[model samples]
Target: LEKKIAHQDAIERNAIEGKFGEGKRKYGLGRISARLQTTSETVIALQFLVMNLEKVLRDTFLSFFQIWKALYLFVNRKKYTLIIEK
Candidate 1:
């Protein structure tokens, strides 16, 4: 097919720039896998934590996210800080 040939041509060109490695330079598998590797993730703002609560409590929400990212966010509901990872 025209499209498949064009895609193969593009992959061959991209693989040269990708310069994978002697072992990784698998032409057919490399080209096909590269096409399949374009997966993605989506994150919804979900809601702004600040907008729902009183001004005095804004600090708490900011504190939660900072601390959560620190822990890689294991708990869905976390209250009190525990320095799980540093």
Candidate 2:
């Protein structure tokens, strides 16, 4: 059980590290410009917020595409059946 928990923790840590790495590379978060500690913290928070919003948007689009594909296939199947009947 302890080993399993340790593995899970490592996976979580890796995911967080990956997110930070991505933010640093993509959003210029590697070097914060603010001198004040609070300002720097806020900057980091905003960067993560942007990242989360982007992720949510991408996921939403993917889900919408999947639903659209399913609906298209269903409609096409019905059309094909009608053609066969005629």
Candidate 3:
């Protein structure tokens, strides 16, 4: 049980660290130019917010594209069947 708990904690730590690494890579979180403590904190917070929002937006767009693709395929298949019957 103790080992299981430790493993879960490590997994959680890795996930959190991965998000920070992503923000640094994609949103410039590592290069905050703010000179004040509060400003820097705010900058980091905004970067995380932007990262999360972008993920949500990207997922939404991908889902929309998938739906559109399915619709297109369905319509095209119907058209081909009609052509073959005629």
Candidate 4:
């Protein structure tokens, strides 16, 4: 049980760390050059917000594409069956 819990914790930690690493590398989270504390906090918050929005957009697009592909294949399958019978 202890080993299973440790493994689960490591998996969660890796995912969290990967998100932070992605933010630092892509969203400018690592380079907050603000003068005031509030300004710095605001910058960090905005970066995280942007990251979350991007994730949502990406997931939405992926779901849309999958649905579209399935529909396309379903329609095409009927057409192919008709052609094969004729």
User: Each model's TM-score?
Assistant: 0.22, 0.75, 0.82, 0.73
Worst 10 residues of 1 by lDDT: 40-49
lDDT of 4 by residue, 1-86 (tens): 99999999999999999999999999988898999999999999999999999999999999999999999999889665644453
TM-score of predicted structure 4: 0.73
Question: What lDDT score is found at residue 23 in candidate 4?
Answer: 91
Q: What's model 4's lDDT at 11?
A: 100
| The best candidate in terms of TM-score | 3
* Local distance difference test scores for all models: 0.49, 0.92, 0.91, 0.93
Q: Could you give candidate 1's per-residue lDDT for residues 1-86 as a string of tens digits?
A: 99999999999988765643422353222333222233311111112122234444777888988987977745633665566876
What are the candidates' C-alpha RMSDs?
19.1, 3.4, 2.9, 3.0
The local distance difference test score of model 3 is 0.91
- The list of candidate 1 runs beyond 4 A from truth reads 1-53, 73-86
Which has the better TM-score: candidate 2, or candidate 4? 2
Ranking by lDDT: 4, 2, 3, 1
Model 1 TM-score (2 dp):
0.22
Deviation in Å, model 1, residue 51 alpha carbon = 12
